[model samples]
Target chain A: MDFAPLLGKANFWAYFFIMLTGLYGMAVKRNLVKKIIGLGIFQTAIMLFYVSIGSKEGATIPILTAADAAGRGGIDAAAYINPLPHVLMLTAIVVSVATLGVALALTLRLWRRYGTLEEDEILARLRGDPGGEACTPRS
Target chain B: MIQEINAAILLLLMVCAVAALQVRDLMGAAILFGAYSFLMCLQWVSLGAVDVGFTEATIGAGVSSALFFAAIFRTTRRTKD
Candidate 1:
């Protein structure tokens, strides 16, 4: 069997692997921070997928020259990479950072209230039974 | 040749994901997740998506990791269960 197409499409596989790793981490990790990190990884993988699809072999940066903008020179699509994905990625980056900041702030508040980062500990504190005489209230 | 390289990178990503999931330590998992982002950035670069790679490296590996670590600090780093 000819594996030519598969062999040629290296970017696809790389992105796929990265995506899987991130998702698995998010799914299996118990810690809140770890899960957030996993989410970051997952986002990154998506970004990679978007970017890869916008590129082509031997393409240059997508910056437009004054000559092209003025319409004095013909545009050469072959010479430049697609600019749309890049623009989108910039916006995504900003959003991701903002989200991360908010998530961190929330985590800090959670820590203060629960006195622990562990999921089980937080649940215990929420239940008002922190594994002690206070929790049991012996008669 | 290109496919082989991608396959290798993909394999690395899989390993990182497995490690992130298997690790008992939360901090370690966060770090692995960061590594996963880094690998993804490289993948983007290979695809000629420089802008995407730049953002991934900055927000994914840098800002996100910092946030996760901060969150970890706020929460318990150790697991009771």
Candidate 2:
């Protein structure tokens, strides 16, 4: 099969690999904090990928340059990179930050309640195992 | 030209990501994650998304790392397989 097009699309492929790395960390890591870190990496990778798609090879920044305003020639929109993706990414970044903050807060609460961050340990406590004396009720 | 810089940055990002995942020490993993975020921010800037890059720097590299540190302090820093 022809692989030239895939080879040329380096940015997309790179970001895809990054995203999968994050997913693997989230899925396989045993620590709650590491899972959150993985989720953050995944989010950033998606945002970067979106931003890359809005760029053009020869275009300048989206802002109106002085030359564009003073020139007699009509301004061509195609001369500037697309701004919509950037705007959307800004909003997404804000939301991602807020979500990360909330996730961290919850994690702190979980840590305080359980005295540990390991998922398996916490599960063992919840299941009323012999070693989880703190979780067992007094007779 | 610019593509070469981007390729190098991507390579760094991959390395940081692997380090973050493989580090046995939780604190070390957190620090590596911060580095990974900063590298991702640079990649965004190189791709011409200045605003996104700034946001990533502030949120991903700055506030997020601070919050992670705080959470780490509040909990045990040990991770057993």
The Cα local distance difference test for each model comes to 0.71, 0.80
Per-residue C-alpha lDDT of model 1 across residues B1-81, encoded as one tens digit per residue: 655676677678778866766677778877887887788677767666777778778887887777777777656567531
Over A1-139, each residue of candidate 2 has an lDDT whose tens digit, in order, gives 9755654466787788889988998888778888888888788778868888997777776665445556743556877778889899889888877988898888888888887887767877788773755542422
Cα displacement (angstroms), candidate 1, residue B32, comes to 2.2
Best of the candidates, TM-score: 2
Instruction: For candidate 1, list the clashing residue pairs, or say none.
Output: A117-B75, A117-B76
Residue B14 in candidate 1 has what lDDT? 70
Candidate 2: docking tier:
medium
lDDT by residue for model 1 (A34-66), tens: 666667667766776777778876777776666
Instruction: State the TM-score of candidate 2 restricted to chain B.
Output: 0.94
- Candidate 2 chain B lowest-lDDT run of ten: B72-81
Question: Each model: TM-score of chain B?
Answer: 0.89, 0.94
lDDT string for model 2 (B1-81, tens) is 677777788889988987887787778888999999899888877777788888889988888889888888878678753
Q: What lDDT, from 0 to 1, does candidate 2 have?
A: 0.80
Model 2 Cα interface RMS deviation (Å)? 1.6
After superposition, candidate 2 runs with Cα above 4 Å error: A1-8, A68-74, A130-139
**Reference-based lDDT, residue B13, model 2:** 91
